[model samples]
Target: MVIATMFDHRVADGYSANMFVSSWADITRSQPPSFLPSFRRSVLNARRPTIYTPSTANMFISLSKLPLIQVDQKNEPNLDQDSLRSRIYYIKGDQLKKLQLLASENGCQRSKLESFTSFLWKITAKYMEDSGYLDHVCNIAVAVDGRRRLSEGEGVEKEDLMAAHFGNVLSIPFGRIHSKDLKDMPLTSVAKEVNKLLKTAANKDHFLDLIDWVEDQRPKPLMSRPFAGTEKAVSIMVSSGQRFSIMDKMDFGWGKLVFGSCYAPAARRDYYVMTMSSPVKTDDWIVYMHLPKKHLNYMETHASHLFKPLTTDYLKLYD
Candidate 1:
C-alpha cells in the first residue's frame, strides 16, 4: 500500500500536505479520521491591535526592503532549477541514537530530529568553508508545527480543534551563523544552537506574534528572512515526518505499507530534507533529500556510515 502525493509549495507546506494524506488514509481504512479538515479562516485571525515583536520581524522579511540582485557571485555558480537533485537514504537506528546522545550530552534533552539537524548544519558549514566561503552566512531552519503549541493552556478540546484545523500552521525558526564559526563548533554546541533556535518558536506567543506580523504585512509578499538578505547565504529547511504514522496506520484493506517516502521535483531548486520512519525497520529513518550536488557529495563522502543508500535489498522488495 504505497502512495505518492504531490503538493504545490506555494499553496501548502509539508505539514499540511502530510495531514491531508493521513486523513485520506484513515477514511480509506473505514476508520474515523484522526484530523478532520477545518477550513475556517477565523482560526488564525489577526489580533485587533496588530501587535508584533522584533523576533517576529526577524523570522520573515517584507518584499519591499529586499536589495537589488548582486552580480558578484564569482565563485558561486548560478543554481538554476536544473542543478537541484533528489536522493533517498536509510539511516540506521543506532546511528540516530548515537547522534541523539551526543547532542544531549550538555544536559538539555534534544530530539532525534534536532540532533540530525545539528549534524547536517555542521556538514553544510564545512562544505561552505571548503568552497572558500568561510565568512558567508549559513542558515538552517526547522519547520515547527504550531497547532499544539498555539493552543497551550486552552484545554484539550481547543488543542484538538487546532489539530483538526487544516492549513499551514507552521513557523520556521532558523539559526544564522558564519560558516567558519559553525564549522568550528562542536557537535554538542551545534545541537545547543539548534535547540535554542527551536525554543524561539515552540511557544504560543511566537505564533501569535507571527499571525499579527503577517496581518500587518497583508497584501505584500513575504519571504523567510534568511532568503531575503543580499549577503551571501546558504539555507536549508529540515522537516520531520516521524508522526505521520503512514506505515502503521495507512492500511486500506490491501496490506501494510511496504515502503513510502516523499519526493521533490528537480525543477524546484530549494534545499530541503525530510526524515520519515522506515516501514521495515521501526527505528530506522528514510531520509528524502533535495539538496545541491556538492552538498550531497560531501555527505556521501564524509558521512557515508550514517547515510546508506536506499535500495531494493534493504526494502526486501524482490523477496
Candidate 2:
C-alpha cells in the first residue's frame, strides 16, 4: 500500500522542467561583466538540473548571539563537518527486505527507514565511543502534503488528479533525539518518539495551526529553507514526491520517463533525504542522498550489507 502520494503539474518530460532552468541560465549569461564575478560564474557554470548543496562559506550571516565565523571542524563534532559526513544510502534486494520488515514491525513504512536507522546509529555511537560510530544527532523531518489540509470543500477531483496542484503542499515535521539518548534507551522508547511526532504532524488541524504560526512568525513572505539557528542540528527532511501525477506526463517528444526523483545536495551538516518513484519499476523507489564523508564511511563499514551504491547508469546520469 502507498503511504503517501504526490501530485505533479502536467509537463511533457523532465526536459520541460529544464525550460525555467534554461531561462535562469540565459538571464545570468546576458548580464554585463561589471556584475559580481562570483554571481556571474555561478550562473554561467550552472548545470541543467541544479542540486542545492549547503556550504559553510559565506552563506551564514553571523548574528550577535552566534558569531558569523567559519570553522574547519572535520575532526570535531561541528555542523560543518557533520553535514558533509551525512549521506543517503540506497536500499534494494535483501536490504530492502530487512527494512520493510523493520518498518512493518514498527507499524510504519519504508519511508521512515532512514530516521529509524539514524536513531539506532546515534544510540550505538554514544555508549560505545570506541565503536567508531560518529557522535551525532538524528532527526527525521517528514514532509506533510498541505493540499488537502488547505483545500476547500471535498477538494477538486480534477485538481487532485492532475499533477498541477500548486501552492505550498509541503510541510516538514521533524523528530530529533541525540545518539547518546538512543544508546541508553530501548528501541521501543525510540519508536514511541518517532510515532508521536508522526501522528502529531499527520493531523489536518495541526497543520492549519502550523500555517498560522508560520504566517505570524514571518509576517511577510519567506522561502522554505532550514532555519539558521539550527546549524548544529543533524536533521533530515524526508519528502515523498512519488504521487505527483506529472511523472506519467513525460511526453515531450521523448518517451516516458522510466523513473523520476529529486536531487538534494549536501547543503548543511544536517541530513537531507528524499525518496521518489523509480522510473525502472513503479513499485520500487530511487533515493538521492548527499551526506558527509565520515558518516558515509561509517555506514559503509557497519551497514554495507544494507545499502547499494546508486550508479550513474541507474539514474541515467550519462544521458
Candidate 3:
C-alpha cells in the first residue's frame, strides 16, 4: 500500500501530485476528472505595478545575498553531499497526540504537521550543535500551496473556481533560526516561530506582493528560499499533505487508493521532509525524509522507536 512516487522537481511539487495521480485514476476509470490541468502562464503573470512588504523585502535580500542552502561548504569539508540518504517512517496518531499535548502544555498551539516539524527541527539543531555549528544558521523552508492564497490575492471569491484552481502555484516560505537558539528553545516555542513566519509568507497578501516583486525583477530567474545560499548552514524544507483527499478525490474507480506519498529527486542537495496521509491508519501519518546519511544514522540509533522503516511487507505489496 506504500505508493512511492518520484517526479521531476520541475514539472510538479507536492501540491500538484494529488491532481496528477487523480487524473491517472480518472483515465483508468474512463471518467472525466474534476478539471483539466491549467498551465496558463497568465496565472502567475507579473503585476503591472510592483509592491512589497518590508518583511518580504528583507527575506528577498537575504536570499539574494546569503548562501542559504549549500550542499557542502568548503568550510565543512568533512561533510559529503553524495553521502545523503533517504528514510520512510510512520508516526502513530497516539504518539502525535502526546506530542501535541506536550506542546500545548508549553502554551503553544499547532497542527499535527507543525508539531512534528518542531520535533524534527530540534533533532536537526542537535545534530548541528554536535557538529560544532551551533552559531550557524539553520533554515526550515516550508512549501505552501499558493493557489487559494493567490486566487484570494487577486480578489477572487472563495466560491469561485480559482480557489480550487489546479496549477503549479506554490510558495517557498521559510524560517531561519540559529542552531544555538533552536537548540535552547522549547518545542512549542519553535513551532510558534515557524507558524508565524509561514503564515506571513503563505497569506493572500504575500502572493500579491510576490507577483509584484517578480514583476519588478522581470526577465530574471526566480529562486525559492531553499535554493538560494548556505555556506555555513544546516537546513530542511517540509511540505504538508494534509489537504490531499486520498479517500475521495483519488477514487477514479479504484476502490479507495490504499496509500500515496512523494519521493524527492535523488540528486537534490538539500534535506527534505514530507508529511503524508496513511491509507489504512486514519490518525497516523507517513513521514518521508531525505537527509544526510550521518544524521540519519544518528536518528536511527537515537529515535528509531519513533520512526519505523517502511518495508514492502508493511505496505502489503507482496504475498
lDDT values for all models: 0.84, 0.46, 0.71
Query: Quick one: best lDDT, which candidate?
Result: 1
TM-score of each model, in listed order = 0.92, 0.60, 0.85
Off by over 4 Å in 1: 27-34, 73-82
Writing each residue's lDDT as its tens digit, candidate 1 over 208-316 gives 9999988888889888877665777888989898887666666656777777777887666668899999988888999999987877888999999999999999988
Q: What RMSD does model 1 have?
A: 2.1
Which pairs clash in model 3?
A: 1-315, 67-229, 67-230, 68-229, 68-230, 69-229, 69-230
lDDT of 3 by residue, 1-319 (tens): 3444556555766556676777777787888875566656666776666778766654443334554354544555454468888788887888888777656644556778777878888878888888666467888888877777766634545324453455556667778788888888988788887777778876778887876776676555456654465445677888888777654457656477656666767778878888887766778788888988888887777777667787766666665
Which window of 10 residues has the lowest lDDT sum in candidate 2? Answer: 35-44
Worst 10 residues of 3 by lDDT: 59-68
Candidate 3 residue 70 C-alpha distance from true site, Å: 12
Looking at model 1, residue 310 earns an lDDT score of 92
In angstroms, the error of model 2 at 85 is: 7.7
